[model samples]
Target: MSADNEIVELKSHNSNFILNIFTDDYKKAIDNIKQKFERGSLLKDISVINSINAKDLNIIDIQRIKDFLKTELNIDYKEKKIIKKNTKEPKKEILKENIPKVVKADILEDDNYKTKIIKSPLRSGASVSYDGNILVIGDVNAGAELIASGSIIVLGVLRGFANAGAKGDKKAMVIANKIVATQLRIAEFIAIPPKDDKKSYSGVQMALIKEKGIEIQQVN
Candidate 1:
């Protein structure tokens, strides 16, 4: 198979992290998974992983990979059923006729496994936690807390405790229009602004993990 055909695609939907395996070869699938792990491209905090296109694999092969993933990476594995279209039906032809089309409204729903948006400000004593990114439309007042497995973005000032990359993703960042947070954290690293520090920053600011530490920088 070509290199592109051997690649594995990972996607998240409704709290399920799905791995789409293109090739049915067991060895190639294992190698591809290992490569992704080594490159730190996989999410380690997810409890379950759903595999697509794995129906052709035998029971033994499936069990082997399941054990490897659960034992080595602490991630559960499941094979999803493939939905196939009916191939025995004949094609139908449509006559050239004018028909009125029905228009429907498209309802947008929030996917809890992806980013979550908060429309109101976080008052003191308020706490929020999510498995994915978080977008806050208002200020995060002091004594409030925000924790996310992914990144966190604040449209207003962030003055409370905010922890991004709570699942240990070092690449995640925390961004805000103005940040004077009591404490900021990315992955396992934490940075607390001095109590006496009263410096103001201009424009949007971002805090990310750099050299095993959290660094705050102004975003242009």
Candidate 2:
């Protein structure tokens, strides 16, 4: 940006754009990245079509970088690549049948659902969102959150807030071995207990949203 010649209309026609910045500008870009990350600006809309120069583009998470732009400056940009298919040859149609269908809310029950296992502690500021049952083999600590489109299970502990059925899945539940949550939510339901309800030994507790209210029970 120090260059007296400011950005003008690009010279390449029908070609993808390159920031075309100086290599030293990387430091400034990194500073900007750190600032946005600390702010927890969630970039909702942005995508990565492809990569150009690997050396230049591989330095950062391009998707999150786009998100940072949108979050910090309200800018959404997609760097697209033009792919020209061979028109002369016969078009080979490949069916995509192996991809699993993404599950959403309104399951009516958390039973018969497959639980996703995460073998790590939920660190502060770290968030996880899933479409099926979420089972963490670690603690859900304070200032951390676990949100599931389906049910959630903690193999170790659940101390922070856990939100089940973030996308209107009213039947989603929260199951934890050690319960010490700051708050809890299921579907449109929410609960904030008066004290840190620490469970003795290993116990199984389930949470549900009944009539838009969070309810808990010792199931096992």
The number of the candidate with the highest lDDT is: 1
Off by over 4 Å in 1: 1-113, 194-201
Worst 10 residues of 2 by lDDT: 97-106
Candidate 2, residue 170: the lDDT equals 66
- TM-scores vs. true structure, each candidate: 0.48, 0.47
Encode model 1's per-residue lDDT on 1-220: one tens digit a residue: 3356655767787666777666667777878887787776446556677654465554335445655676777776543434566545433323232211110010011122266778899999998887767778788999998888678878788999998765545667788877789998775567995453456665677788778678877765
Task: Give the TM-score (vs. native) of candidate 2.
Answer: 0.47
Candidate maximizing TM-score: 1
Error of 1 at 83 (Å): 24
Candidate 2 lDDT by residue in tens digits, 104-183: 22222224344566778898887776655676777888888777756787766688878776544566777666567888
